[model samples]
Target: MLRSFSYLTDHTGFCGTIKNSPSDFVVTEIEVTEHSLRDTQAKSLQKPMEVLLGQSSPGLCAQSCDGGGTPVPADQGLRWAGDSCPASPCQNQHESKAELKPGLEDASVLDSLLGKAVSELLNKYACDLKDVWKSKSDANAGTREFSLGPILDKKNRADLHSAIRQKFPFLVTVTKDNEMIVKGNADYRELCQFVTEKETSDFFKFLDAKLENSTFSFEPDGDKEHRKVVHHFINRKFGKLLETKSFTVTDVNDQQNMSIMVRFREKGWSRKRPAGGFQEKQDLYTAFTLQKENLETLEAISFLAAELGVLPSDFSYTGIKDKKAITYQPMVVKKVTPERLKEIGNKMEKKGIRIHNIHSACQHLRLGQLKGNHFDVVVRDLKHHSHDSSADLKKRISEAMENVETKGFVNYYGPQRFGQGQNVQTDQIGLALLNEEMVKAVKLFFTPEDTDDPVNNAKRYFLQTEDAKGALVMLPEFKVRERMLLRALNRYGVNHEGCTKGWLSIPHSMRIFYVHAYCSKIWNEAASYRLSIYGSKVVEGDLVFSEETDETISLNDKVHVVTAAEESAKKYSINQVVLPMVGHSIKYPGNKVGQWYHERLSKDELQTCKFRVSPLQLNIPGCYRPILKNVQNLSYFLEGSEKGIEIEDNYLNESKVSLHISFDLDPSCYATVCLREIMKCDF
Candidate 1:
């Protein structure tokens, strides 16, 4: 089979070169030895470009002499941008543009150089230049076809790019346009090896087209075989797409500036220590704190630690909350030094930030956490309302929660919301980027063979966006996953690469496991899980015996809740579970009831309601239908308070976010569930 190879170039430069190289336009004259479509090497070669330049001004050639006597070629005006070519290390020193083309029109020369670079790159990669051009021509002549193989997906692309960066950094180009240009360099050569190992060439073609500001969409093709081939290549290189490790810290104390210890499960090269590997299950820890100074922002004690040098680097937080409101989150820090830890404590005290506690942990948090966020909000300003208004609001909230199976909040933009009205959009761009990253990770693990190819075939299994619109749109599924990931990141933010927040963490001695379930239409499927720490299998039937409901079965209720495991058990280290809640109710007239959340539902502020502190239930739109649901939904179990109000089996699913709270004498006596209820108070 004839392999097709192509290269894109600056349009103006391409036109000039095509005009001058009529004789040697085919592959025979300009030789190409490599077949890599991606960045393979970083050598700065300027030979082909030199030849192209000579074709325009023959007088500049060394052979341009008169008579039999040896004569030197006249210096035609043409300046070299830099001193010497980056590719030729031992050759002549590069000439200055002023010296080479002092009198030549500069603009035209720039145009020529652009085209020359493209031609040079093409000849360098396409050993059989004639075959590549013919293939491209055939593609153009045959139905204007383009192929959207799986490799173009965001996740796969990210993986390929990451590999290129690690293996061949110099070949990568970061242009103002965000377009990655791979000139001849070590990275470029590695990319060729990476793609060739995948046993496919389609992805390379796509990358080549992208380099020229074109896309696979330009010549649309429907044969997915190429995509599958690329996918196989990706799978061969990367294993599991979504693999994460979590650590539990036991010595967490908000008061002492102690460090929390943690480790990983699968193991890999540690950014903190190069000596670490994937086999020995790494072990390390850091010191930090999480505080809800404001209702919106959950500032970490490690923020100061990073400034003071307690931890190795700043840290990584999942999300940034509002500065005006009080919030709580999780964070993680990598390795830290003792001197840096003391400095961190001093800084926190100076800044009036308290360190709650620290503990030893077994691993680093990759994603997911215990339950969801518990939001306690206070709404100011009051209007004339009957005593029943609170009760009605509560009722409405309850009904609304059950009906949607997702959580929602008042249109209060938490600093991240971007759109407006019916078109209101959230911080989806960030979510989209995360999804792209996940896809890339999957590709990287499952298809290491195709590490260099540009197209990411693994995207087909997950949600994907178009070529130009990627990293901008977040599907509902991605959004939900992102929320959980963000929570974990925030809770354990630490000195890490490419993270937003510094280091942060959460301390909890008690451990519990919740089964994350999914429901779609009438059928629901739950994937089995094993002990994260001890590697033991857990069965759903062993956890929940059975549940009795009083109300008539509704669409939401129609979904079966197969108790996978106990909500709270010491044996399980997993903290939270993700479940998809959906109701058959619509926006219009229905038998469904609703309630007001994040606010006191009724004036019965004195009424004591008993509730249990079940895990927080985060409700998000169906992965397929997010736009239909305006707000990201979340709810949790607020069973009872310390006062012990007689609680029913299910008070109100809508009012599930509220639970009574009380403080006995010490702050340690504070109950997370009770605190949740108080936060919902209208006061």
Candidate 2:
């Protein structure tokens, strides 16, 4: 799937050892709460001490208010509503529960509850985080926040909690009835005690003591089903043990869960690939128990970015990861010292986080965040309906590709999606498009259009009679014009308008020439696509390379028809030499002349062709050029001129292909356009 090349200059490779290997640094202080879980059960009398003052307790911090026995002014009440009091406040103390006002049940409250639940639900979490701080003599481990979404709807919160308890009772406590009371013996004191328990305290204290070693570790139960137990410990301990630090731990396999049976191989650690993988592995850095999230990947990057001293720009990822799918992505950070990396890892472990391993990477790793992610997705629950079959799905995909262009679907580098954890603006995409277009336009002029204008001393040639009569002028093929264009490109810089703005001779070199030619090709291709879409005939239309010469007679007077082969030849001749001929080739006097002769004689050579700038050109600069094959486009069209075949057809016909793929990913990433190469699909 990935390859590397070693060249003479150095041990080189293409898509080499994935740069920016995913860095698993321990972050402290970054805590994320699962938004939805089962309703919490109140701490029983015996569990009271453990519930309060415990790292994994229902983090209920209370503030006493003058419990005015009489209904205080509604304005002075704690903003909760209930059945006993119409549109009332003071936390709705009816004997049942506090019902939030219609839109007043803030997301933050749910978030808080979820955070509290995350601690209470997982015993290891409670032990590592709670005990650390309760036992102040022990140093704190770091903290890390993780994210879980689709916060439970208030109605479902209870059921979800129950399910959670059934699955992970040690992690959470489920209640059968509401226990919030604002009056009498059932007041704030009970609530306060319910949250700060000795169990939670001891948990945090344990992590704190563990942190003294500074090395982190994940001791997952190799059994896949029990992985969640490991992650539970990691998250809770990290949150409670470390006074200030954040970390993220992710599994490196499908189910991209946060759980792991990861144990530090202190004795077996070596700089060689692990049993199943092929990387220069290293010693397991830290160790601790872990639990899985039963979802997609763990977004360690976001957590690290927010908690550690990592800048948004400091990270690049390969895939637009799935938050629910347990997946691991290569990570990298620049401008940071090893000490810093170690410090971060240590801080994380001190709080109950375990760093499975840490080894130096030669290059930075990115999660394919650029150019968007590549995906192969498979859909389930597909019905074989006579009306809605796989064929229909394929048809829908094909149809969508032809009709509309999605706006928000930007042509930006993938990292743009996480714009500093902000939103991407239309203006940025627009600028990127514009810049690409201009670059392409420049390249186009360098190759095909460069020779349009004559060298003042050169004999300006023309095919005299231009009266639109079936007149064909195959004078010297398309290469002559292409050379001229290449020459012109060498001499002048082409602007967006396709006009020369400045001049440069072969004195400089080919790099500039390449840049110029590449840009122009992009611009022309964009234009050509637009023209084809608008019902224009580029197939047989007047393909002109010009400083318009007055034809002895106007061609408009008659219709001109030319062979497709001639058109192909001309297009090839003009663009072929633009990119490859410059600098040293320029130094050779007859190099251009030789190229001109070679292209004119070779009727079989295929070349890329395009017109001036178009919108799409703004994204991918460069016109279609002569190449062995355009694999990306071949699935739909007859690839190159496979022998000299001629067709008198008036229009290009549509051809379709069937495509099916399956994808497994972390959340927050989509497969909208990943299948473009196979079949264009957009909605």
Candidate 3:
């Protein structure tokens, strides 16, 4: 059962709009593909397009390559067999110091494909670019040519197409198997080679038209991954579509398909760490679409990285995703071969994790490197109002959606935002931390709940009573971090330094996360207050953010404050302004807003000004985020409609109507807010 939250349905006023189920909500991320800078510009730039084209015809493209070329991603021909190489490539993949072949940087390859010795052509454009053109076989007479520099650096689209096509040919010739036959005269063949083997076949569709026709013409294929392009709605969508499901139904299925998906496309590199021999430093990047629902990003990556003889810390990713949903993200490991990565991925498939689209990256991924996330949530078992007719239900949904689109709603943190809600919330612990109540914070972390498990309750009770020895003994092996804290207490007593060490023992990411949740709680309450008073219109000096700039705000950048004029100039431009995520460097929205933060901090006994700066310090460089989210592509339909729906076979209750709704939201924004506005029910 999802933990319930106060004000969850306050906006929508329909608390139990739809029966809540884990299977009902599905979130799929739209990944940003990063390309290597050293590779041919055409190869790097075509990644996203390559991914989309591969998905265009699942039947046609599935059999084709990933990211064009041979489809093993980047150069798959980095061989391990050689005089210098060990006999077994599989056993010594990490030790194999196979240098990336010259083909990737073979600018001369483009000469044959582009039909021009790039040295002369580049020199014609600008004599200064002489050094940019590499001459593999130059006589040094200054008359030689080979290829172009950082291909996309200054080259325009026309130049790229020209470079892509050494020469434009009249006919697209295909073999009996429908593979396009490469010919010197046909530069279109060269361009087609840049596309997937499946997509290359499509070029022949117009070949019949081109052979008999006067001019070349064909409709552009639809990019497989079509973006909604509108925006996310964190405020009004969530909490409304749900009715708190009872925990009694033990057999209910919350299948972790992650079909709605932890796929990250990290674009950076790490130092190579080989298993046996000195490793060749190569830029290793692999974008994986993980069908893993039960595994954390770190957990799955750690397992695979270990296979490559690297630590989980060696892998870099944009963000971690929910363990219960299907996800795709990019992961970067330096110097790891695609073959080894693929082999481990294939191995993982047996354990319910399917990894795909292994590729190379030029840049390493840091946290928060994302555009946003797309969600396809299904709300089941609509508890219909007795008097409401079918038309009325539809009208209600439409009007609710329209109102949200017009005025927008409060972007409160959802129940799941803090935690499962069964235990004392993280935000509450964060509040304790803010107040310098380390003991209280640690105690909350081990809150004794009246749970089905006695050992857990006993462990919590021992920790609660300061029986550190008992707590340690009672704590199960699964409570690894907690055991460390209890052991510290047992050894050092409840002194300040001991408590600090105990807290510090937790992972750095997690330690900061508690504070983040606290900040989120503060922001949510503050946002709710603003919504109650100001509605959607801008008040004088009220903070606002433009749609375009909001996404750029990071934990590192100073919080953006909207001016009164910026708020008025472009209508919707300054709609959903941000609030600070309370940190040492944060400047509160002065006036009542700023005062509100101080007041809340005071209530928690927290000193507002006290924050640490070191990585170990809790004084984080918190960024600003929109108080309200703008939702896009808002759509809903009855589960019994043309859109597929199913009856609950596991539940003991009668089957009710299912409402399937789909929308997109920004990264980190909760979709529950939109449902809250739609249902108008108190959750």
lDDT of 1 by residue, 1-683 (tens): 00111111111100001102112111101111123211222111100011111011111100110012221112211111121111122122222111111212233332243355643443344344324433565433222112112332433333333333223222232221123333323323333443442222333322211211111111121334543443344333322211111112123343322111111111121223233222222234443344434222222433454464443233433334333333344445545443445455555655434443454322233211222233333221211133223423334334433433332211111112221121212222212222223232222212212233322232222223222123112212222222233344334431132122210112110000011011221011111111211122222322211111111112123222223333233332211211221212211101111111101212222112111112222212221111011112234333333233433543333322233211121110112212112222211
Q: Rate the local accuracy (lDDT) of all candidates.
A: 0.25, 0.27, 0.47
Supply the global lDDT for candidate 2: 0.27
Best by lDDT: 3
Clash count list over all predictions: 125, 167, 50
Judging by TM-score, tell me the better candidate of 1 and 2.
Answer: 1
Please give each candidate's TM-score: 0.26, 0.22, 0.54
- For model 2, the superposed segments whose C-alpha errors exceed 4 Å read 1-302, 316-328, 335-357, 362-376, 380-566, 569-671, 674-681
The TM-score that candidate 1 achieves is: 0.26
Q: Write the per-residue lDDT of candidate 3 for residues 1-683, one digit (tens) a residue.
A: 12233232222322243325434555666554344322423343222111111011111111111232111121222222111221112111121111122232354645544447654564353333223222324433233332333332222322333222222222222121112122222222333434442333333222211111011212222332211110011011111111111011112263221110001111121123234442243435555555565555655665565567764555665555655555566556655666777877666775446767677554345432455567667665555345443433444555666777665555566655576534788788777666667777877887766674755765667665788887777665445456667887777777666677777766555676678778788777777666556555555456543221111122223234546664566333334456666666456674477778788878876654465524246655455666666777777655553356643333212144556778876666667666776665434
TM-score of model 2 (CA atoms): 0.22
- In model 2, the Cα lDDT at residue 359 comes to 47
State which candidate, 2 or 3, has the greater TM-score.
3
